[model samples]
Target chain A: MAGGGDELKLLGTFASPFVMRAKLALSFKGLSFEDVEEDLANKSQLLLESNPAEKKVPVLIHNGKPVCDSRVIVQYIDEAFSGNGAPLLPADPYERAVARFWAAYVDDKVLCHVLEAARGKTEEEKAEGLKQTLVAVETMEAAFKTCSKGKPFFGGDRVGYLDVTLGGLVVWVHAGAALYGMRLFDDAKSPFLAAWVERFGALDAAKAVLPAVERVVEFAKMRQAQAAAPATAGGN
Target chain B: MAGGGDELKLLGTFASPFVMRAKLALSFKGLSFEDVEEDLANKSQLLLESNPAEKKVPVLIHNGKPVCDSRVIVQYIDEAFSGNGAPLLPADPYERAVARFWAAYVDDKVLCHVLEAARGKTEEEKAEGLKQTLVAVETMEAAFKTCSKGKPFFGGDRVGYLDVTLGGLVVWVHAGAALYGMRLFDDAKSPFLAAWVERFGALDAAKAVLPAVERVVEFAKMRQAQAAAPATAGGN
Candidate 1:
């Protein structure tokens, strides 16, 4: 739990992997916070006011001060609550830089490509997105080899910033496999990451925060069905 | 200067704002580094190996360990040389988070839209980009007001991370006016930012790193002429 005077409140939806990053960070740190579920369709006044520019979720309010963006929020949690938990960022400056580099890679290359693969407008676009995603995954596998150096995690025997950043997508990875028959990390290609997925997902903290895979699959299905409904009606 | 034992090298192109960010950070921190100019058209092996994933410039090598990405490099410089100069990130965690939020906004919102407006595919695309750029500029103007707190700089009386992040674009802001008659910040709309451009550019450290405006304008014109040549030849 956080120090008595500190009040942490997370404004996010259940389904967002970005939101999950914040939850996982908090859980790993053992910091308790009010998990405020948001209706993105009808964004709350707090959400709008908290992040007036972007109005995106996963805004972590610490002692009434809003820290927007998951990456910023995660780092904030680590820095603000430094004494309560194992540090998310490393002590050494160079190591911290490396961790930050990979954390950025996870978002810029991996997550963005994955989203494009799943949500592209055309089959060709989706195929291109998948192709780029495979390249990103291969690059990430190499990064894992370098960073982990045979350790169980990227942080060399501990869960750190990169772990938490990528850990957010654990459920979605399963959901992607279920819906598309596409496993991002597989035994054939990215063997290290393939094993890492299982290892990371099995963590108690991760289990607590990560949404159920079946529930995510159902949500995705519902979203797809809704998207198709308009097209179907238009055709009629 | 950096500590006696510390050796710093930066790989970057002169024209790139991303590269300028790294330069600005180093300068503001009063760190002396060997500035190695990279021919982006034919990248160096060091850059390729240093950043295998992105192969982008602005890779800072400290004692031979390469840190890629401008954002990561800036933060790394601050951390690695904590004792050398004034801290780029604020000491308080909340303030650091706010600085980061604005730094990200500068990149994702302000710079990106500016690029789109300048180099969009069609007239309509350019127009839309300009419209978005105006919106982003307005938001950033407000950010400047809130962050600076009636002070001269975003760091409040000293140059900080957000200043360096946005400072990279100071030359371009001048060049844009010369080329496209588009001033992203103007007295009428974004008075703070308009004044900020002039104040940030005049600093000794900033002046040392920032490229000349006329040089940038000449380079832009040359590039534009080259682009037109291919189209002209194809038409003929």
Candidate 2:
């Protein structure tokens, strides 16, 4: 399975950051996979069959075996394709645990608040969510220091699990600033993460997979307009 | 670090199912550790320092390094003590991913609904939570067959990652029955899991650490009564 003959396919949408995480991992690992785009409004049978539990995108099918969830898929890629490229996770058990903890934080704290800010019903609630998102960013700024240890990247001079996990949102940061005048990370507030954001975005692998900021901003606007309109079938 | 000289300490509360997960992993791995019970109401400085991000329990301190979160701690225990006992996670990468997927299902689908059932503000909401929890149980029943492959456990003939993960809720299953006449798993609803509930609970390793069922029921009742009472400081 680790050989070049392995068949890897990803079922995902273009705009999903979660799906982007999977693409980023595959790109970083230097594994060429068939990118199968799914219409999220009317999901594909492959996506449904692959992940009946969540019925969500970002299902990485490696040689016909499906790995669902972005975090799980990233770890699966690192483990299954260990011989492909530089390791996404460090070898030390303790360091691996630390990476896992912060990766989970990226989704649980940062992404959760980002969604809340986007979807909150009231102005006050959205403001609070934005405030907490910044707080989460500050926390991750500290985590970037702890995990990177003053190195160029979280995996210490190479992108790793944490980088790919948070990297899913790099384009969204730019789109967010364009849409809501929000800056998730800034030079004054989260200098390390702000710098890392640019450094990470500049990488050839990341640049190849990350959606363009204008495209994401347009997509977000369309979704917002759709959400504000009357309810209809296949709203997602 | 895999030697017998490893220093392990756990900062946790008695009744936390999450903390019980770490204990179950340690006990299954045949490793001994200091169980430093925490006053969650007034959490210790050690707890605060150990887990500054969430400040929650089930923080496993191994050789003075803190590993926060039950899921992370369990994996750390397995990797750090790989030779101490039978491996908690399987050797195969795909199988490991499957185990992780279901272990997460236990928390996201099962535990989340269980908490909603216990904490929902209205009767309708609580009933909905209970309904969803049962549906999740049925989903896991099918997952057990997929992972176990007609074997005794999710790890196949022995407790593995999923077992230890869902094992945290075994006591709660019994306590729920006593408290609300609720059978989360039954002969008809989930025959395999119903039998597994009994088999897993009877293990010496499990009995050694699992809190008594009656004690949990009493604790739940006390907490419910407290919730109905007036507000006060340090209520947790």
True contacts kept of each: 0.94, 0.86
lDDT tens digits, residues A132-177, model 1?
Answer: 9999999999999988889999988989899999898888888989
Question: Each model's TM-score, in the order given?
Answer: 0.97, 0.97
The true-versus-predicted C-alpha distance at residue B156 of model 2, in Å, is 0.3
lDDT of candidate 2 over A1-236, digit per residue (tens): 56878999999998899999999999999888999999987999999999998899899999899999899999999999888878999999999999999998998899999898889999888889888888889889988999999998898889999999999999998888899787788888898998998999999999988889999999899888888888774245
For candidate 1, the lDDT comes to 0.91
- Model 1 Cα displacement at B146 (Å)? 0.9
Interface RMSD of each: 0.5, 0.6
Error of 2 at A234 (Å): 8.0
**What stretches of model 1 exceed 4 Å from their correct place?**
A231-236, B231-236
Per-residue error for A123 in candidate 1, Å, reads: 1.7
**Local error of candidate 2 at residue B159 (angstroms):** 0.8
